[model samples]
Target: MSASLEKGIHALKEQVDSTVAAFFSSCVHCGMCADACLFYTETGEPERMPINKVEPLRRIWKSEYTLLGRIGKLFGLTKKVDDKLLTEWETLVYDSCTLCGRCSMVCPVGNDIALMIRKTREGMAVAGHAPEGLIGATTRAITIGSPMGVKLPALQAQIRHVEESTGKTIPVDVEGAEYMLLLSSMEIMNFPEFIEAVSKIFDRAGVSWTISTEAFEATNSGIQIGVSDLAAELVQRIVDAAEKLKVKTVISPECGHAYMAIRWEGPNLVGKPFSFKVRHILEVLNELREQGKLEISSRETQKLTYHDPCQISRRGGVINEPRSLLDMVADNFVEMPDTGKMNWCCGAGGGVSSNERADEIRLKVFQRKKEQLDAIKPDAIVSACSNCRLNLEDALEEYNMDIPLLSLTEMLADHLAD
Candidate 1:
């Protein structure tokens, strides 16, 4: 009843709409996706190919939906979806693939292989083939309102610290603010300086924004675990808060998947568009700069490069906003090789970081990002996503590399006009 081959096949059948069918039909087997994938490229494993990860879904769609597949199924010639097949694909789909969409970009036939992977995860999760770490995180997210189990009181303590540090009172539940800010649990726990930095910058820019005690945790483990029901429940908390507080806009903090969850997938999962506009915090900062509200006192002297979070840049189209903000405060900014929309993933996205079993392979696959960093050899690395920053720091320490990881917002705050 919990996770069976019959349930997985049914989920796969339901997921294979016209679009998935078209992608399966159009895939020319060029194998370009293999090269574009970090796991495949780093390990030289054929099973890690983006197209191959969703083979079960493709085979199910073919046999059940397509004419030739129906004949094959009638003759018992089509590949069957079984426990063994699902067992073999679990690691490839959950641990190796971050759903970064780089393969989608590189597809010669314009196949959205990454989307298929995301869809394939739904079946995997229902089949009880999802990673245990992700399952625990999803449970925490739905039951405790945060994947990390961060409670409102924890955020309250952080707010008090920021308020005392910045001499600016951080607002909470103040009706009719111009913007509502959402922070990832990581920011609350590891990088409280983010809240302090945001408070100072917003004070300087004369912006009115408040943190939501109702839904402060922006990271959606449900999305990472590929469960829409749980994802929608997590998103609705923010919607309820935004509406209750009557905020004009909701600013997604510097978490890649968090931004993607609320800004891109929130409405779709909830079956309606948001009443207030959702902007990545970088986008909001850039808008402030465009309005001539953001003034910088000086520029960074140390040479630096950006590690673009794949969701914010490639998937969300917030490419120029971060660079534009960086230009205002960083004097010696340089591009990492294959930076921007085509940048490499941190290998810990899409709930991989939460999955303890993925630790070894995650670090191994990070060679792709390590190569990108080696090519640039920048003095410092700046990134918008806290998850990417944390992963980069870990990998840097692992390689004994000397580099400082800086948050784009924190860096900007340091150079604020006095």
Candidate 2:
């Protein structure tokens, strides 16, 4: 092997050793996590099993830290690490697993496999083994403040377009506002109605809110791409904008990953908890409902089923608020068998939404979710995350299935008193 490749292999081994040790130390391996894994059930491959999924990492850990490993290495009972081995691990770590963390829920020892995957991603990134699509998105976000590469002027133009469509003037960076609304690039570029809905809701509620054209986007492609430094830097932009606006609270638009990045991981990413409170749109709408700021007199008159975005439902622990709002708006609300925290992933987690190479696998994996939606035969499908919405849209197109996609904000906007 070339010296560069050999060095890379050694570094990867160290990373695997530490990450696997952490994961193994946290796990009792009681098999309770088996039921939570979709890959295990779908493929029935023991290697694909959640407990066994970490075997590659475990082998590296044992080889490095155990006495048996030392004896085996001295005697040549175990094969020496090589380039082929590193290549295999690269595929297994990046392409084979989705980092869904359903396993953590059933783990008796509270081992967070999702964190292990993320740490593994750090090693892969250093080795330049990351998925190209995610790397491209991260590059754009670093350069332009959003994955979509929407600049400040383009963002302003989009906001203007939204204003023209909805007849609501979205004031940008108003000083001393009670709230600063943060929008994901998905909303601004692909789903402008989500932004319009948020504006309409705030306007009808008589709540003072402003948008920051400077820090307009809430999408953190850095987090998706597994770069901690870049993720923290992007989050700091949002934090600085919030401080500048002097808002008492910041409201996130209807995007799942955006909500998770800002609300759940923002403080940790930025090294300190934000002084201002952060909330998702559903939470905001629920508050509006409780405060009598929102009134829905008529149902949506459509049969609808809700797809729980993993970030919002599992990571963010927000399952009920969106359902409550949907119940109020939909004439008939049907739920997938595995709903709420237990819901199946749309196969778009961990930046897989943009990975073209993984697109086929993503669709195959999401076939389960598609089956659930087909069973309900709903008029529309509602989700709180942009990635999930986009993935589902693709799935619908791929399978020749037709289901309208609506964000929770859009549904609430439809029911809002005009």
Candidate 3:
């Protein structure tokens, strides 16, 4: 066996804990997960089924962890997990599966199919089978401290612009701030308006918040590419910065996976609890609203619907906060069928947007989102996650649909009482 293959096998072996063994053994081979997956639903491809994507992991578990399978392996009767198998599964594991957790939600036996897929990616990555795009992102995250390679100077430039335009000082590296804000690289690069919006709202609400120049980037490519050690390294940077500044809360910006990385997975990856608390921007905004700190002078008259970013809403337990915030600003708000935790994924989440090889498939599976919008026929779609917003914009443009996408934070900021 090649060195890479040996390492991959070893890694896969390590991933087969009691939970994985239980999940694999308890699976009823039900087709529920297949139907829950948009890639499978859109294309009717059997390989796109969520449970099937982890076939390599399942094989490893059986061959290594089961007595009957171990005997079969000794006789060369069991299927071996090799380079050929990993190569074939690269597309299934990375391109087709979004790690959105929708399949996990629908599993009859309560299996976390998404988690298995993520674990399977651990082996795939170590085996040198991860997509070129994800590999590039992981490298940039390690070397530049931002997956998109955003530097402190770029953020400083954006801060200068927001402050100059709005006449509000955007604090950075301020010690003892009540909250330390984090921004996804997408917000830093593709949507600086989010930063402007946060500045305006925080200023109006009298909220004490600061950004950290030391660890401003929120999205973790290490989590995306299934490198726990690297993911831990990235999370530790934020924890260290937060502790150093003595901030009470770290606000995860409107980036879904960033919130999941920092708020949900950060503690486990770092092997300790964070010194400061973590909250999604929506949760923070909602808290401000309940405190009567957010005074909205106007409301959206045009019909609006909210798209729940899979990570931020379904997986993160942040469903109601966005809806509450939207209610404050949108008079004509509507719900797409299966909204909130049960909502369909944007098809570009969980690093699918980063893989160029998945672009065609990504847009193709966007039919699921298109159908959701078509049912509601809203004039615009409001969402919190910047990555989801960008992907929605791309898919909407490709479909020749002229519906506009709006940021909930920006909407609240725009309607703040003058």
RMSD of each: 1.2, 3.2, 1.0
Q: Which ten residues in a row have the lowest lDDT in candidate 3?
A: 322-331
Q: Could you say which candidate leads in lDDT?
A: 3
Ranking by lDDT: 3, 1, 2
The residue-level lDDT of candidate 2 at 145 comes to: 82
Q: What is the lDDT of residue 390 in candidate 3?
A: 95
lDDT of 3 by residue, 203-309 (tens): 88898999999999999988888888899999999999999999999999999999999999999999998888999999999999999999999889999999999
Task: Estimate the TM-score of every prediction.
Answer: 0.98, 0.88, 0.98
Compared with the true structure, all predictions reach lDDT values of: 0.90, 0.76, 0.93
Candidate 3 Cα RMSD (Å): 1.0
Ranking by TM-score: 3, 1, 2
Report the C-alpha lDDT of model 2 over 1-418, residue by residue, as the tens digit. Answer: 6665555445546556454676676777677766666655655555555666445455556677768887887887765555565456554455556666677676777777766666556545555667888888888888978887778887788888989988879988898898888887777788878878888888889989998876878888777666777889988998999998898888877777788789988998899989899988788888888898987766788888898887788778888998888877888899988788878878777787767777766777777777778778899998888888888898889989989888888888878877
Stretches > 4 Å off in candidate 2: 1-22, 26-35, 40-48, 51-83, 107-110
What TM-score, to 2 decimals, does candidate 3 have? 0.98
Give the least accurate 10-residue stretch of model 1, judged by summed lDDT.
Answer: 1-10
What global local distance difference test value does model 1 have?
A: 0.90
Error of 1 at 138 (Å): 0.5
- TM-score-best of 2 and 3: 3
Which pairs of residues have clashing backbones in candidate 3?
none
